[model samples]
Target: MSDTAREGDAEGSGVSEGASGRTDAHESGAERTAASDESSTDAREPPRLDGWPLVGNTVEFVRDPFGFYDRLESRGDAVRYSVAGDEFCTFFDPDYVEQILVAENERFRKAQILRDSAAGFAEQGLLLTEGEVWRDQRVRIQPAFTPEKIRGYADAMVTYADRLCDNLADGEVVDVGDAMSELTLKILAKSLFDVDVAGRRAVVREATAALNDRGDASGASAFLPDWVPTPKNRRFERAMSDFESMVDDLIAERRTGDESEYDDLLSILLDAEGPDGTTMSEAEVRDQMVTFLFAGHETTSLALTYAWHLLGRNPDELERLRAELDAELGDRRATMADLPDLPYTDRVLKETLRLYPPAYVIFREPTEDVRVGPYHVREGTNLTLPVFEIHRDDRFYDDPDEFRPDRWRDDFESELPDYAYFPFGGGPRHCIGMRFATAELRLVLATMARELAFEPTYDGDPDLTMAATLRPENPLEMRVERR
Candidate 1:
């Protein structure tokens, strides 16, 4: 089902994986000495592996990247895999990441694969756009996520978080993941639109979930053009239609002057002006709203999922977090003004994101022939950096798999290199809502930690899944007990 061609060897350039243990750039010609295989430092090729036939390693990849990475790293870091008739590779090495996001960024832009693939849902929003458009949108829209604006959203963020905690009865089993999703959606709606969007949350959630399905691009759905007729196409269309309809209604309602209208992302986008002084149109506003909604609602919730699961297993970290909150809030509430003081809470979030970055591959295309790490990428080639694998590398992190927040505590702060822990991505095109997402996360975490504690409901080992976002394969069934 998933493609697994001879992914190890790249186009007759035989990168032999042998017992001799040489895994690095294989030299082939003059004036180009291959990268030395630093055995003591790293031996993994990149993050890619050569797969078989037309299917490449898609099937293997969809199953479990962690396991796949373990095997690939055992052989070498960078392994080449073919997909969709293209020679694409996934990279876990930080040097490659730096090349893609920083050093050679001007030459590499977001690959067209994601842009065209995601065309089903939304087109050319912040995520898919390239070059000038992305630059302009980011510049105009970034100011809204300034610390001051995030601070403004904090009170409402705390309020919704506490309300979520309050609803958690001592003995009831709850899905913390789903609860956080809903909580964030509400917070976004109220703080941005000044209206409670509980009525519209489900349709939005369902539509969003559809966008995450890798299956849409697989099976029968893959055969059809994005606009063509098919189940996946229909699903994509309906979701897009519903999301836009909601935005249109909100905009119309805002035009008529709802007394409740407040200054949130929607308002900020609508009011944002490019250097040329052109404000975003209603359609642009809608796209930006969904983009922020996808980011604001989904990523923060998934981060919480990983954080909760890790904390549940680590009593020491849990107790430390509780102590931090108790000393700061003293059973009151996580206030906007108090955000500056919660250092440990921020540490937990950073560590969670470091361990389980919500974004998978940050893609870019080469504008010119360039070297990512060891691979000499020609122009028009697409490059992807797997943030998930890189974050867990022992090189950047000590005992990488272990859930230790203290890794980010002392010298680790100064030690964190650029592109090392890019949960929000990097470059000029990095997420504009980074500050906002952090603000939302802190609010929800503090409020929930004060009142509710989640105990996972799984009987055996925890399950991990990589759909649109990395999460527990099943709904996070957990007992939500009030403290």
Candidate 2:
């Protein structure tokens, strides 16, 4: 890891030294005074990265977001950089991350960029809503994710995994990413809506691909105006329209059926009431469905995809995983009851999440001027919690980039800082489906490892793309070998 203190002291670095250090070179005197009075401390502005005129750091960031954030880590814990004309402060220190996500969470709101991007699909859902709306939605949706409810979904998860494994032929080359996406989507459909999405898989896949293209920061669509007739934007609109139609069909079908016959998440949303004794509106229900459908399946599939990729490259790890599965679940499918004895399987998933977090970054904006460490951040300044960069930081883990599941075998997590390994994020706004996703990952991995092994069809690392989720830039092809 880079020396945090030494980086701040480097010549020409924008980071201030102490509470009494001078303000950022660009900060107006009046603005600096207001920040000092708000915090009643001599907090200076964080370090700033120099970029080209007008475009700023947008080009570099668009070119390679992971590399861009990695470069920022060498500047200081808190570094300011711009994308296009918009400025954002990224926090690298775990303590500051905790403050932003947990300690002083109320002082920040979900970043506007995220809201704008998601507005096309899930505007009123738990992912984008704020204040009363978010709180109520979370309250209404909490019951479906309780420990008992999640455990109940394990059978369906394992069943779907077995189905996928059975469909694959020995020595057949497969697009592992697509296969995982299909498996998780099926698992999610059954667990969340109590329906089969076998027929709608193509639509979901198309819509998800379009969403990724539209939301990807590395693409030109990200910087263009919404009204602009960009090719990607046009495709996104068509895909969303089809996707919304599918959601409407699901909702309409459920509305016409006996509500008491179903006990999945869709039914919960349909029957839930707020403190005011009102149920969600039609549009709100659609938003919730879209939110869960996208968020729930997409992240878990990516986790499984990356896990397969990593395990395929590491034969020793693959053998270890198979040994654990064979010992715990020999010739039988995995169940929730067997999770405790499958510690190695759990560690493999954890290691994969650390290396390739689906939600790479969490964006938040301060609601008011606040002091973060020795830095004075103004209200509405974008705060980025780079989960991807932090996960791979050498400061937190030894050989951070290597895919070694056994690293999690000891008290490593117990000794790590709170926000150092937050793959699902932290605080009040963390991923609500965390438990569900983890359970799905472990069960699917166990079932697949028990019956088969994967061998990579390509060489080196598959190129990675960043958007709302971290995914491979190309199809991750692998050969399916029956164990």
Candidate 3:
């Protein structure tokens, strides 16, 4: 999917060139606004297509994101554009993305639209909060993702994979995406709270389906305010509430009743105490549990689903993966101990992450004035770092448009810049459950490789649709064959 990076610099990170993107000046987020202005002011602005009145590329961007982002990066690392009254300068450069994530944490923050859209969801988890609120949540929940704990979940992951394998015969057509979603949701749900949800599938499915449906563009909350009285908004609230309630009840059961009743992820979270021996409040605990259940499930499920799609379409890669797994762990489920030994399999996952990163667009607002490249970014300005674009940029990769897992060789480790390959972001604000997600993905992939082989029945051109995260737009049909 990417070319071997020439140097060890983290991909899409460090040291910017000159002017390509600019933002409206704001006074509050002052420090966010850096690097000598001389280089920026002299550099010519990048080319941009005109949009109606003030809404530049908003409609077109929403309609065709890949095309929208590709056009911006066609000329240089960064591109300038607008969305109605909001002026945005997107950074596809690795250095720029790197700086935003690692170098300038406080300079940039999550955008207002997301902040408000998820405001109602704030009490539901850690992802929606910023600053101290986010830090506090992270403190209490971090222990659940420790290497030792993630290792424990590997057995459960394999068990779920076995259950998934049992559901589909060797040569039956099935939607791999749907299957992976269910399997991942079940594993994540149980891993977080040791509860049997054989009866609760409908409840979980309904809530997840609603979150998935939020991708709709019609009166979309992305465009409309959350307070709007639209049916979609109401539905969103209803579904989210149902989802949150399910998690809240589970937390209550564990805290008050026999704590040993379950050994799931939620239980781990409940039993965890921060460095200061602080425990999460009941609301915070519920929020983090819900957060892990959803965050830990949906995105990776999407990634693995796409990986299956990619492999099903590309027989060569598929064979290579199976061969690797067979050679590495024949007839055995992938244990946490085997993770490091299967570098090639891990590389394949990394490549998939690069090509189809779960969290494609991580948007943040400038809490302080910051300098991105040569331009000074004012406070209140929206900053969108498109990993989807950065991953495909030809500057760092040899063949930017093609898919090739082999490109992630040992040689590129020191060569790629820090932020260039951020499927799971960077800095203190990165995805907290990264280690856990990695272990979970490896377990599922390895298990499926061992127990089953799913090939796309008819090649389906799965479209990338964004809703909270990117997912396969259409049903991904596959022919499942047992190994």
Candidate 4:
């Protein structure tokens, strides 16, 4: 929305930063190259990493993406590499990240890989749509996530957190990831859909796991054509069938009820009208529901799972969190009102997200060739903003890998560059449910922390996997003790 973002409208122009920290106009890459000495090398092309013939960086990237990214980051802020035959350029600098995601976002669209992977399940939803369709979808859905609506959903969040805590017996050993997934699914269902999905948990969980497995960018089937009947594809199809049936049932049931009485996302989508006085078709509504179901709960559950994992590893921080919770809401349920009084709890979640952001990477593709920082990125280049790498970059945080909530105590976020800590992304296209997720995380963590303490069953770091969301390669088990 800034003026800097609009300068890209002119062809053969580039954007660069001045000494005053404002974007300055510059000649296009070709123009600059032509004007310079013929013997001098062009600064437009980014440094490219050498890889094996044909396969390129596929093996290294598939085997250990984190390490591959580490090596990529070491090369330069703007580094280019190949995965199989596909081209990719990762932007590690926050300024370039800001340009891609916020300032000059209009010049980019969602990555083709993402669209291809998500199309089957999330078709035409806000997640995959572009231009006017996406804008209209966002406009229609915006009211459901307003401040008032989010505040209204807080009671459901706290109630479900309380329910999960009450149900967990003392000395119970549970997979923290699965547990959080179930809890968040319930919270999302009740708060957003105004429906109770307690009986449908198994189907939802299976479907979600299947979706994650199929959509794993690192999986073997990632590059295969979707029509290929690979084992993973078969499983994905079955799961999609079951999930679509469930969605259809939910929609039918909602329609049978007093639609005017409900103010949830389902009702909103059912009744929403666009500026042209159009309503979402049945398929569009289904797409929106599917998008929210996967996105709304998956990221938050991962956040809580990592929060507990981090707390379990750092007992001192856990003690500090429990102390804050005790002082703020002793023997009582946590509500939205208690969030202000529980700063340490908030910081713990913030630090957890910083270390283990569920939406670890944001993918974008340039709609036009544009200059980012000192490099000229060609149109259709797959650009990756590695949020995880940025968060743990030593230049940005001291002891970046350490679990230290106190570091976020005050002025920390204010001092950092805008894109330095974008867990939920940024710009007009930022996650629509950010407010809802933030409030849910705080309330749920507060409620659960008040009644239960987690002891991590594993030692040291858990093996991580890159997927639709960042997940533990193995189940993260934790022993729950009643507080």
**Model 1 lDDT on a 0 to 1 scale:** 0.66
* Runs with alpha carbons beyond 4 Å of true place in candidate 4: 1-43
How many clashes (backbone N, Cα, C below 3 Å) per candidate?
27, 0, 43, 0
TM-score of each: 0.84, 0.91, 0.86, 0.91
Q: What ordering of candidates by lDDT runs from best to worst?
A: 2, 4, 3, 1
Which RMSD values do the candidates have, in order?
Answer: 9.6, 8.3, 6.1, 6.1
**So what's the TM-score on candidate 4?**
0.91
Cα error, candidate 3, residue 317 (Å)? 1.7
**Per-residue lDDT of 204 in model 2:** 88
Question: Against the unseen true structure, what C-alpha lDDT does each candidate score?
Answer: 0.66, 0.81, 0.68, 0.79
Model 1 regions lying over 4 Å from their true place: 1-48, 62-65, 75-77, 214-230, 258-262
Candidate 1 lDDT over 378-479, as tens digits, reads: 566556677777788777888988888877776675465545677766444555556667777777888888776788777643666655566666787788
Q: State the lDDT of candidate 3 residue by residue for 320-341, as single tens digits.
A: 8888888988777778888778
lDDT of 3: 0.68
Candidate 1 residue 376 Cα shift, in angstroms, is 0.6
The lowest-lDDT stretch of 10 consecutive residues in candidate 4 is 11-20
